[model samples]
Target chain A: GAGVSQTPSNKVTEKGKYVELRCDPISGHTALYWYRQSLGQGPEFLIYFQGTGAADDSGLPNDRFFAVRPEGSVSTLKIQRTERGDSAVYLCASSDGQRETQYFGPGTRLLVL
Target chain B: AQSVTQLDSHVSVSEGTPVLLRCNYSSSYSPSLFWYVQHPNKGLQLLLKYTSAATLVKGINGFEAEFKKSETSFHLTKPSAHMSDAAEYFCVVSLRSNDYKLSFGAGTTVTVRA
Candidate 1:
Protein backbone atom coordinates (compact mmCIF):
# COMPACT_ATOMS: atom_id res chain seq x y z
CA GLY A 1 0.00 0.00 0.00
CA ALA A 2 1.17 3.48 -0.74
CA GLY A 3 2.08 5.67 2.23
CA VAL A 4 1.81 9.39 2.82
CA SER A 5 4.18 11.44 0.69
CA GLN A 6 5.48 15.00 0.99
CA THR A 7 6.98 17.15 -1.73
CA PRO A 8 10.10 19.31 -1.84
CA SER A 9 11.93 17.10 0.65
CA ASN A 10 14.06 20.12 1.41
CA LYS A 11 13.35 23.81 1.09
CA VAL A 12 15.51 26.87 1.70
CA THR A 13 14.13 30.39 1.97
CA GLU A 14 14.95 33.80 3.37
CA LYS A 15 13.22 35.66 6.16
CA GLY A 16 9.85 37.20 5.32
CA LYS A 17 9.41 34.85 2.36
CA TYR A 18 6.51 32.49 1.99
CA VAL A 19 6.65 28.73 1.54
CA GLU A 20 4.17 26.01 0.82
CA LEU A 21 4.65 22.36 1.75
CA ARG A 22 2.53 19.74 0.09
CA CYS A 23 1.29 16.38 1.35
CA ASP A 24 -0.36 13.45 -0.40
CA PRO A 25 -2.19 11.08 1.87
CA ILE A 26 -2.81 7.42 1.37
CA SER A 27 -5.71 6.32 -0.72
CA GLY A 28 -9.03 6.23 1.19
CA HIS A 29 -7.63 8.10 4.16
CA THR A 30 -10.04 10.72 5.49
CA ALA A 31 -7.93 12.00 8.37
CA LEU A 32 -4.83 14.11 7.77
CA TYR A 33 -2.47 15.95 10.08
CA TRP A 34 0.52 18.26 9.93
CA TYR A 35 3.28 18.63 12.49
CA ARG A 36 6.57 20.46 12.95
CA GLN A 37 9.72 19.00 14.48
CA SER A 38 12.56 21.21 15.55
CA LEU A 39 16.12 20.10 16.18
CA GLY A 40 16.52 17.83 19.21
CA GLN A 41 12.81 17.94 19.90
CA GLY A 42 9.76 15.86 19.20
CA PRO A 43 7.07 16.67 16.67
CA GLU A 44 4.38 19.16 17.62
CA PHE A 45 0.92 19.13 16.12
CA LEU A 46 0.14 22.01 13.77
CA ILE A 47 -3.20 21.22 12.19
CA TYR A 48 -5.56 18.38 11.40
CA PHE A 49 -8.22 17.73 8.77
CA GLN A 50 -11.08 15.30 8.97
CA GLY A 51 -12.08 15.61 5.36
CA THR A 52 -11.87 18.90 3.48
CA GLY A 53 -12.08 21.05 6.57
CA ALA A 54 -9.55 21.65 9.29
CA ALA A 55 -10.88 20.27 12.55
CA ASP A 56 -8.13 21.75 14.66
CA ASP A 57 -5.50 24.42 14.18
CA SER A 58 -4.91 25.45 17.75
CA GLY A 59 -1.34 24.20 17.64
CA LEU A 60 -0.40 26.73 14.99
CA PRO A 61 2.22 29.01 16.52
CA ASN A 62 0.57 32.16 15.21
CA ASP A 63 -1.55 33.58 12.46
CA ARG A 64 1.33 33.22 10.03
CA PHE A 65 0.76 29.47 9.78
CA PHE A 66 -2.19 28.16 7.79
CA ALA A 67 -3.10 24.87 6.14
CA VAL A 68 -5.72 23.72 3.70
CA ARG A 69 -6.96 20.36 2.51
CA PRO A 70 -9.19 21.22 -0.36
CA GLU A 71 -11.24 18.44 -1.98
CA GLY A 72 -9.62 16.07 0.47
CA SER A 73 -6.83 13.56 -0.20
CA VAL A 74 -4.19 16.28 -0.53
CA SER A 75 -3.12 19.17 1.69
CA THR A 76 -0.84 22.17 1.64
CA LEU A 77 0.69 23.99 4.62
CA LYS A 78 1.46 27.64 4.06
CA ILE A 79 3.77 29.75 6.16
CA GLN A 80 3.75 33.50 5.66
CA ARG A 81 6.56 35.85 6.61
CA THR A 82 8.82 33.00 7.58
CA GLU A 83 11.31 33.53 10.34
CA ARG A 84 14.45 31.62 11.28
CA GLY A 85 12.47 30.06 14.11
CA ASP A 86 10.22 28.51 11.50
CA SER A 87 13.05 26.29 10.33
CA ALA A 88 12.20 22.66 11.01
CA VAL A 89 10.95 19.46 9.46
CA TYR A 90 7.32 19.66 8.42
CA LEU A 91 5.75 16.20 8.68
CA CYS A 92 2.43 15.00 7.31
CA ALA A 93 0.43 12.00 8.46
CA SER A 94 -2.78 10.31 7.44
CA SER A 95 -5.20 7.86 9.00
CA ASP A 96 -8.34 5.99 8.00
CA GLY A 97 -10.37 7.94 10.58
CA GLN A 98 -10.18 4.98 12.95
CA ARG A 99 -7.81 3.26 15.34
CA GLU A 100 -6.08 6.54 16.14
CA THR A 101 -2.87 5.45 14.44
CA GLN A 102 -1.24 7.60 11.76
CA TYR A 103 1.17 6.89 8.92
CA PHE A 104 3.74 9.59 8.31
CA GLY A 105 5.48 11.01 5.25
CA PRO A 106 9.15 11.66 4.76
CA GLY A 107 8.60 15.30 5.63
CA THR A 108 9.86 18.56 4.12
CA ARG A 109 12.80 20.16 5.85
CA LEU A 110 12.48 23.91 5.67
CA LEU A 111 15.35 26.21 6.45
CA VAL A 112 14.74 29.91 6.82
CA LEU A 113 17.98 31.76 6.26
CA ALA B 1 -4.09 18.19 30.48
CA GLN B 2 -2.09 15.28 29.01
CA SER B 3 1.60 14.81 28.41
CA VAL B 4 4.19 12.12 27.64
CA THR B 5 7.64 11.68 29.10
CA GLN B 6 10.55 9.56 27.97
CA LEU B 7 12.65 8.70 30.98
CA ASP B 8 15.85 8.40 29.06
CA SER B 9 16.99 10.84 26.41
CA HIS B 10 19.47 8.26 25.05
CA VAL B 11 20.23 4.59 25.42
CA SER B 12 23.08 2.48 24.04
CA VAL B 13 23.04 -1.28 23.91
CA SER B 14 25.19 -3.88 22.17
CA GLU B 15 23.69 -5.74 19.27
CA GLY B 16 21.94 -8.94 20.41
CA THR B 17 21.45 -7.47 23.88
CA PRO B 18 18.15 -6.56 25.44
CA VAL B 19 16.79 -3.04 25.00
CA LEU B 20 14.48 -1.04 27.16
CA LEU B 21 12.95 2.41 26.63
CA ARG B 22 10.79 3.77 29.41
CA CYS B 23 7.78 6.03 28.91
CA ASN B 24 5.26 7.58 31.31
CA TYR B 25 2.08 9.39 30.38
CA SER B 26 -0.26 11.78 32.16
CA SER B 27 -3.84 12.16 31.02
CA SER B 28 -7.12 13.24 32.50
CA TYR B 29 -8.83 10.24 30.96
CA SER B 30 -8.03 6.93 29.37
CA PRO B 31 -5.67 7.67 26.47
CA SER B 32 -4.49 5.97 23.34
CA LEU B 33 -0.78 5.27 23.32
CA PHE B 34 1.61 4.61 20.44
CA TRP B 35 5.26 3.98 19.75
CA TYR B 36 6.94 5.41 16.67
CA VAL B 37 10.46 5.13 15.35
CA GLN B 38 12.52 7.41 13.12
CA HIS B 39 15.71 6.14 11.59
CA PRO B 40 18.11 8.91 10.74
CA ASN B 41 16.62 10.84 7.84
CA LYS B 42 13.67 8.47 7.47
CA GLY B 43 10.12 9.31 8.40
CA LEU B 44 8.31 8.22 11.54
CA GLN B 45 7.22 4.57 11.56
CA LEU B 46 4.62 3.03 13.82
CA LEU B 47 6.03 0.32 16.01
CA LEU B 48 2.87 -0.47 17.95
CA LYS B 49 -0.19 1.00 19.63
CA TYR B 50 -2.35 0.33 22.66
CA THR B 51 -5.94 1.46 22.36
CA SER B 52 -7.44 -0.09 25.52
CA ALA B 53 -7.73 -3.52 23.93
CA ALA B 54 -4.59 -5.16 25.24
CA THR B 55 -2.02 -4.43 27.88
CA LEU B 56 0.76 -6.13 25.93
CA VAL B 57 1.17 -4.99 22.35
CA LYS B 58 3.53 -6.47 19.79
CA GLY B 59 4.92 -4.61 16.83
CA ILE B 60 7.14 -4.88 13.80
CA ASN B 61 10.76 -6.07 13.84
CA GLY B 62 10.30 -8.01 17.05
CA PHE B 63 9.50 -5.00 19.19
CA GLU B 64 6.91 -4.92 21.95
CA ALA B 65 5.50 -2.65 24.64
CA GLU B 66 3.59 -3.15 27.85
CA PHE B 67 0.94 -0.76 29.08
CA LYS B 68 0.78 -0.35 32.87
CA LYS B 69 -2.04 1.79 34.05
CA SER B 70 -0.91 1.63 37.67
CA GLU B 71 2.37 3.22 36.73
CA THR B 72 0.94 5.36 33.97
CA SER B 73 3.72 3.81 31.93
CA PHE B 74 4.09 2.30 28.47
CA HIS B 75 7.58 0.97 28.14
CA LEU B 76 8.90 -0.42 24.86
CA THR B 77 11.19 -3.41 24.90
CA LYS B 78 13.04 -5.67 22.53
CA PRO B 79 14.37 -9.12 23.28
CA SER B 80 17.42 -8.48 21.18
CA ALA B 81 18.66 -5.24 19.77
CA HIS B 82 19.55 -4.97 16.10
CA MET B 83 21.74 -2.44 14.44
CA SER B 84 18.68 -1.38 12.53
CA ASP B 85 17.05 -0.44 15.83
CA ALA B 86 19.45 2.45 16.23
CA ALA B 87 17.07 5.33 15.82
CA GLU B 88 14.97 7.88 17.67
CA TYR B 89 11.87 6.51 19.37
CA PHE B 90 8.86 8.52 20.40
CA CYS B 91 6.00 7.79 22.76
CA VAL B 92 2.80 9.57 21.86
CA VAL B 93 -0.50 10.02 23.65
CA SER B 94 -3.92 10.92 22.32
CA LEU B 95 -5.79 12.44 25.23
CA ARG B 96 -9.12 13.02 23.64
CA SER B 97 -11.52 10.16 23.18
CA ASN B 98 -12.09 10.88 19.51
CA ASP B 99 -9.61 13.54 18.47
CA TYR B 100 -6.95 13.47 15.78
CA LYS B 101 -4.54 15.56 17.80
CA LEU B 102 -1.55 13.81 19.38
CA SER B 103 0.99 14.86 21.98
CA PHE B 104 4.46 13.37 21.62
CA GLY B 105 7.26 12.85 24.08
CA ALA B 106 10.75 14.31 23.84
CA GLY B 107 11.91 11.01 22.24
CA THR B 108 14.67 8.58 23.15
CA THR B 109 17.69 8.08 20.95
CA VAL B 110 18.90 4.48 20.71
CA THR B 111 22.37 3.50 19.63
CA VAL B 112 23.18 -0.09 18.80
CA ARG B 113 26.78 -1.26 18.99
CA ALA B 114 28.28 -4.40 17.54
Candidate 2:
Protein backbone atom coordinates (compact mmCIF):
# COMPACT_ATOMS: atom_id res chain seq x y z
CA GLY A 1 0.00 0.00 0.00
CA ALA A 2 3.02 2.25 -0.11
CA GLY A 3 3.18 5.03 -2.68
CA VAL A 4 6.13 6.01 -4.83
CA SER A 5 8.96 7.44 -2.76
CA GLN A 6 11.97 9.60 -3.57
CA THR A 7 15.03 10.12 -1.36
CA PRO A 8 16.91 13.32 -0.56
CA SER A 9 13.81 15.48 -0.49
CA ASN A 10 16.09 18.45 -0.96
CA LYS A 11 19.59 18.72 -2.39
CA VAL A 12 21.96 21.64 -2.73
CA THR A 13 25.09 21.37 -4.84
CA GLU A 14 27.61 23.63 -6.51
CA LYS A 15 27.67 24.04 -10.24
CA GLY A 16 29.74 21.52 -12.19
CA LYS A 17 29.20 18.88 -9.56
CA TYR A 18 27.28 15.66 -9.97
CA VAL A 19 24.24 14.34 -8.09
CA GLU A 20 22.01 11.34 -8.03
CA LEU A 21 18.28 11.25 -7.16
CA ARG A 22 16.68 8.02 -6.20
CA CYS A 23 13.11 6.75 -6.63
CA ASP A 24 11.31 3.78 -5.20
CA PRO A 25 8.11 2.97 -7.04
CA ILE A 26 5.08 1.10 -5.80
CA SER A 27 5.49 -2.56 -5.04
CA GLY A 28 4.10 -4.02 -8.26
CA HIS A 29 4.63 -1.16 -10.69
CA THR A 30 6.56 -2.03 -13.82
CA ALA A 31 6.64 1.35 -15.53
CA LEU A 32 8.60 4.30 -14.18
CA TYR A 33 9.06 7.89 -15.35
CA TRP A 34 11.07 10.96 -14.43
CA TYR A 35 10.18 14.59 -14.96
CA ARG A 36 11.49 18.05 -14.15
CA GLN A 37 9.45 21.02 -12.99
CA SER A 38 10.83 24.52 -13.07
CA LEU A 39 9.43 27.47 -11.18
CA GLY A 40 5.97 28.58 -12.30
CA GLN A 41 5.87 25.91 -14.98
CA GLY A 42 4.43 22.50 -15.56
CA PRO A 43 6.46 19.34 -15.30
CA GLU A 44 8.55 18.37 -18.31
CA PHE A 45 9.04 14.78 -19.26
CA LEU A 46 12.56 13.45 -18.90
CA ILE A 47 12.74 9.68 -19.24
CA TYR A 48 10.69 6.53 -18.79
CA PHE A 49 11.39 2.91 -18.07
CA GLN A 50 9.35 -0.19 -18.71
CA GLY A 51 10.88 -2.81 -16.55
CA THR A 52 14.70 -2.89 -16.47
CA GLY A 53 15.17 -1.14 -19.81
CA ALA A 54 14.35 2.44 -20.61
CA ALA A 55 11.44 2.57 -23.03
CA ASP A 56 11.92 6.22 -23.85
CA ASP A 57 14.80 8.59 -23.23
CA SER A 58 13.98 11.21 -25.81
CA GLY A 59 13.08 13.75 -23.16
CA LEU A 60 16.52 13.74 -21.56
CA PRO A 61 17.93 17.21 -22.13
CA ASN A 62 21.46 16.06 -22.95
CA ASP A 63 24.24 13.63 -22.22
CA ARG A 64 24.66 15.02 -18.74
CA PHE A 65 21.34 13.47 -17.72
CA PHE A 66 20.92 9.74 -17.46
CA ALA A 67 18.84 7.23 -15.46
CA VAL A 68 19.02 3.56 -14.65
CA ARG A 69 16.63 0.98 -13.22
CA PRO A 70 19.02 -1.91 -13.08
CA GLU A 71 16.95 -4.41 -11.11
CA GLY A 72 13.52 -3.37 -12.40
CA SER A 73 12.33 -1.88 -9.12
CA VAL A 74 14.36 1.03 -7.86
CA SER A 75 15.60 3.84 -10.13
CA THR A 76 18.29 6.47 -9.96
CA LEU A 77 18.55 9.68 -11.94
CA LYS A 78 22.11 10.84 -12.42
CA ILE A 79 23.15 14.29 -13.45
CA GLN A 80 26.68 15.20 -14.55
CA ARG A 81 28.15 18.69 -14.60
CA THR A 82 25.08 20.19 -13.07
CA GLU A 83 24.21 23.70 -14.12
CA ARG A 84 22.09 26.41 -12.58
CA GLY A 85 19.49 25.77 -15.20
CA ASP A 86 19.20 22.26 -13.81
CA SER A 87 17.84 23.63 -10.56
CA ALA A 88 14.32 22.35 -10.21
CA VAL A 89 12.12 19.68 -8.64
CA TYR A 90 12.86 16.23 -10.01
CA LEU A 91 9.73 14.08 -9.94
CA CYS A 92 9.31 10.35 -10.24
CA ALA A 93 6.16 8.37 -11.05
CA SER A 94 5.18 4.80 -11.70
CA SER A 95 2.31 2.75 -13.07
CA ASP A 96 1.40 -0.83 -13.67
CA GLY A 97 2.07 -0.49 -17.40
CA GLN A 98 2.33 1.99 -20.22
CA ARG A 99 -1.42 2.69 -20.38
CA GLU A 100 -2.11 2.74 -16.66
CA THR A 101 -2.55 5.83 -14.55
CA GLN A 102 0.79 6.97 -13.20
CA TYR A 103 1.18 7.74 -9.50
CA PHE A 104 3.72 10.33 -8.41
CA GLY A 105 6.21 10.63 -5.58
CA PRO A 106 7.13 13.68 -3.56
CA GLY A 107 9.93 15.09 -5.71
CA THR A 108 13.53 15.88 -4.95
CA ARG A 109 14.16 19.58 -4.99
CA LEU A 110 17.61 20.27 -6.45
CA LEU A 111 19.37 23.57 -6.12
CA VAL A 112 22.56 24.46 -7.97
CA LEU A 113 24.62 27.34 -6.66
CA ALA B 1 2.31 16.26 -31.35
CA GLN B 2 0.20 16.76 -28.22
CA SER B 3 -0.20 19.85 -26.09
CA VAL B 4 -2.43 21.23 -23.29
CA THR B 5 -3.24 24.75 -22.24
CA GLN B 6 -4.79 25.86 -18.97
CA LEU B 7 -6.54 29.11 -19.78
CA ASP B 8 -6.52 30.60 -16.29
CA SER B 9 -3.29 31.09 -14.41
CA HIS B 10 -5.30 31.48 -11.22
CA VAL B 11 -8.88 31.15 -10.05
CA SER B 12 -10.32 32.39 -6.80
CA VAL B 13 -13.73 31.39 -5.48
CA SER B 14 -15.53 31.73 -2.19
CA GLU B 15 -16.27 28.61 -0.24
CA GLY B 16 -19.50 26.89 -1.35
CA THR B 17 -19.35 28.63 -4.71
CA PRO B 18 -19.06 26.83 -8.00
CA VAL B 19 -15.56 26.41 -9.39
CA LEU B 20 -14.28 26.08 -12.92
CA LEU B 21 -10.81 25.61 -14.37
CA ARG B 22 -10.53 25.81 -18.13
CA CYS B 23 -8.28 23.66 -20.30
CA ASN B 24 -7.82 23.26 -24.06
CA TYR B 25 -5.82 20.63 -25.87
CA SER B 26 -4.43 19.76 -29.29
CA SER B 27 -3.45 16.32 -30.37
CA SER B 28 -2.76 14.34 -33.49
CA TYR B 29 -4.60 11.33 -32.16
CA SER B 30 -7.30 10.43 -29.69
CA PRO B 31 -5.93 11.77 -26.45
CA SER B 32 -6.21 10.75 -22.86
CA LEU B 33 -6.88 13.78 -20.71
CA PHE B 34 -6.26 14.04 -17.00
CA TRP B 35 -6.45 16.45 -14.08
CA TYR B 36 -3.86 16.39 -11.32
CA VAL B 37 -3.63 18.46 -8.15
CA GLN B 38 -0.53 19.23 -6.12
CA HIS B 39 -0.30 20.66 -2.65
CA PRO B 40 2.72 22.57 -1.52
CA ASN B 41 5.72 20.30 -0.94
CA LYS B 42 3.65 17.27 -1.90
CA GLY B 43 3.37 14.89 -4.77
CA LEU B 44 0.72 15.19 -7.44
CA GLN B 45 -2.56 13.41 -6.88
CA LEU B 46 -4.70 12.19 -9.75
CA LEU B 47 -8.13 13.76 -9.80
CA LEU B 48 -9.63 11.99 -12.82
CA LYS B 49 -9.00 10.92 -16.38
CA TYR B 50 -10.91 10.74 -19.66
CA THR B 51 -9.64 7.89 -21.83
CA SER B 52 -12.06 8.29 -24.78
CA ALA B 53 -14.58 5.91 -23.26
CA ALA B 54 -16.80 8.51 -21.54
CA THR B 55 -17.15 12.18 -22.25
CA LEU B 56 -18.00 13.11 -18.67
CA VAL B 57 -15.80 11.75 -15.91
CA LYS B 58 -16.08 12.09 -12.17
CA GLY B 59 -13.07 12.20 -9.90
CA ILE B 60 -12.27 12.35 -6.22
CA ASN B 61 -13.03 15.22 -3.87
CA GLY B 62 -16.24 16.29 -5.61
CA PHE B 63 -14.42 17.24 -8.82
CA GLU B 64 -15.46 16.37 -12.36
CA ALA B 65 -14.59 17.18 -15.95
CA GLU B 66 -16.26 16.95 -19.29
CA PHE B 67 -14.34 16.17 -22.46
CA LYS B 68 -15.79 18.14 -25.33
CA LYS B 69 -14.42 17.14 -28.71
CA SER B 70 -16.15 19.94 -30.58
CA GLU B 71 -14.21 22.67 -28.80
CA THR B 72 -11.18 20.60 -27.86
CA SER B 73 -11.71 21.32 -24.24
CA PHE B 74 -11.72 19.33 -21.00
CA HIS B 75 -12.65 21.74 -18.24
CA LEU B 76 -12.66 20.79 -14.56
CA THR B 77 -15.59 21.83 -12.41
CA LYS B 78 -16.94 21.44 -8.91
CA PRO B 79 -20.41 22.31 -7.76
CA SER B 80 -19.07 23.89 -4.59
CA ALA B 81 -15.61 24.94 -3.64
CA HIS B 82 -14.00 24.03 -0.36
CA MET B 83 -11.12 25.69 1.42
CA SER B 84 -9.06 22.56 1.10
CA ASP B 85 -9.30 22.82 -2.70
CA ALA B 86 -6.80 25.62 -2.74
CA ALA B 87 -3.76 24.35 -4.58
CA GLU B 88 -2.24 24.03 -8.04
CA TYR B 89 -4.05 22.11 -10.73
CA PHE B 90 -2.50 20.83 -13.94
CA CYS B 91 -4.21 19.74 -17.14
CA VAL B 92 -2.45 16.87 -18.86
CA VAL B 93 -2.70 15.19 -22.24
CA SER B 94 -1.18 12.12 -23.82
CA LEU B 95 -1.91 10.57 -27.17
CA ARG B 96 -2.57 6.90 -27.71
CA SER B 97 0.45 6.79 -29.96
CA ASN B 98 2.62 8.15 -27.16
CA ASP B 99 0.95 6.81 -24.10
CA TYR B 100 4.17 6.67 -22.13
CA LYS B 101 4.72 10.45 -22.27
CA LEU B 102 2.56 13.20 -20.86
CA SER B 103 2.23 16.81 -21.99
CA PHE B 104 1.24 19.13 -19.19
CA GLY B 105 -0.22 22.62 -19.22
CA ALA B 106 1.09 25.55 -17.26
CA GLY B 107 -0.77 24.92 -14.01
CA THR B 108 -3.75 26.86 -12.64
CA THR B 109 -3.48 28.01 -9.06
CA VAL B 110 -6.73 27.81 -7.16
CA THR B 111 -7.38 29.96 -4.12
CA VAL B 112 -10.50 29.27 -2.11
CA ARG B 113 -11.70 32.17 -0.03
CA ALA B 114 -13.52 31.60 3.22
TM-score, candidate 2, is 0.99
Q: Supply every candidate's count of residue pairs whose N, Cα or C atoms clash at under 3 angstroms.
A: 0, 0
True contacts kept of each: 0.72, 0.87
Candidate 1 lDDT tens digits, B1-114: 789999999999999999999999999998989999998778899999888898999999999999999999999999999999999999999966655787899999999999
lDDT of 1 by residue, A1-113 (tens): 88899999999999999999999999999999999999988999999899999988889999999999989989999999999999999999999994557889999999999
Candidate 1 regions exceeding 4 Å error are none
Report model 1's chain A TM-score.
0.97
Would you estimate the TM-scores of all the predictions? 0.97, 0.99
Top of the candidates by DockQ? 2
Error of 2 at B45 (Å): 0.7
Candidate 2 iRMSD in angstroms: 0.6
Alpha-carbon RMSD of each model:
1.1, 0.6
Listed in order, the DockQ scores are 0.73, 0.91
Q: Which prediction has the highest lDDT against the true structure?
A: 2
Q: lDDT per residue, candidate 2, B1-114, as tens digits? A: 999999999999999999999999999889999999999989999999999898999999999999999999999999999999999999999988898899999999999999
